[model samples]
Target: MIEVTEKAATELKTLLEQEGKPELALRIFVAGVACSGVQYGLALDDEVKEDDVTMESNGIKLVMAKDIERSFSEGSIDYIEDENGKGFLIRNPSAGGGCGTCGGCH
Candidate 1:
């Protein structure tokens, strides 16, 4: 199952509220794949497909395609703020490797 850190949940709530679509669920998916591993994607979606897996994490609703769920089965979504600024970070143990952008070749 996927988890969301408190900070991440709080940020997600703010973003949803700002979007004026609090009823929409956060959709997470695999956007692409490289030689290193998989890349992720996120968005707010109002429709849930038949093959979607829906769940609540840290009080926020999340949805994902069943076929893409395995890569995120044991991970947590986190919000990080540092010199680089603030953003959402997906910490998936099952992801195996880092993305190609981080000095890794695709």
Candidate 2:
């Protein structure tokens, strides 16, 4: 039940078009673990492993490994642009997470 914010969905679609990979799904994975909790990363992927969980958010396809799905079962993806710059971010309410950045670690 991961949700993609309107801004994030729009930006992701544009990126896919730019890369000529409009059909690729956004893949989410456990990049590492920090004091904030599990750190997740995103990428465009066409492959879905047997243990991968798939879903759609804001009309965008999303895929993640089964092991990491629970962490984001009720999360949302957002795009933020401010003084610090812009990037995608995953917001998981159930987890004590912070500082998961698409551009760089804060």
TM-score of 1: 0.86
State the weakest 10-residue window (summed lDDT) of model 1.
Answer: 97-106
> Per-residue lDDT of 1-106 in model 1, one digit per residue for the tens?
7898999999989998998888989889998876567878888899999999999999889999988887677788899999989888877777656555777563
Q: Distance from true position, residue 78, model 1, in Å?
A: 0.7
Structural similarity to truth (TM-score) of each candidate? 0.86, 0.87
Residue pairs with backbone overlap in model 1: none
Error of 2 at 41 (Å): 0.9
Candidate 2 deviant stretches above 4 angstroms: 97-106
Per-residue CA lDDT of model 2 for 23-101, tens digit only, reads 9999998888876777789989999899999999887999998978766789899999999999999888877745665
What's the distance in Å from true for residue 31, model 2?
0.9
Candidate 2 lDDT for residue 38: 79
lDDT of candidate 2 vs native?
A: 0.88
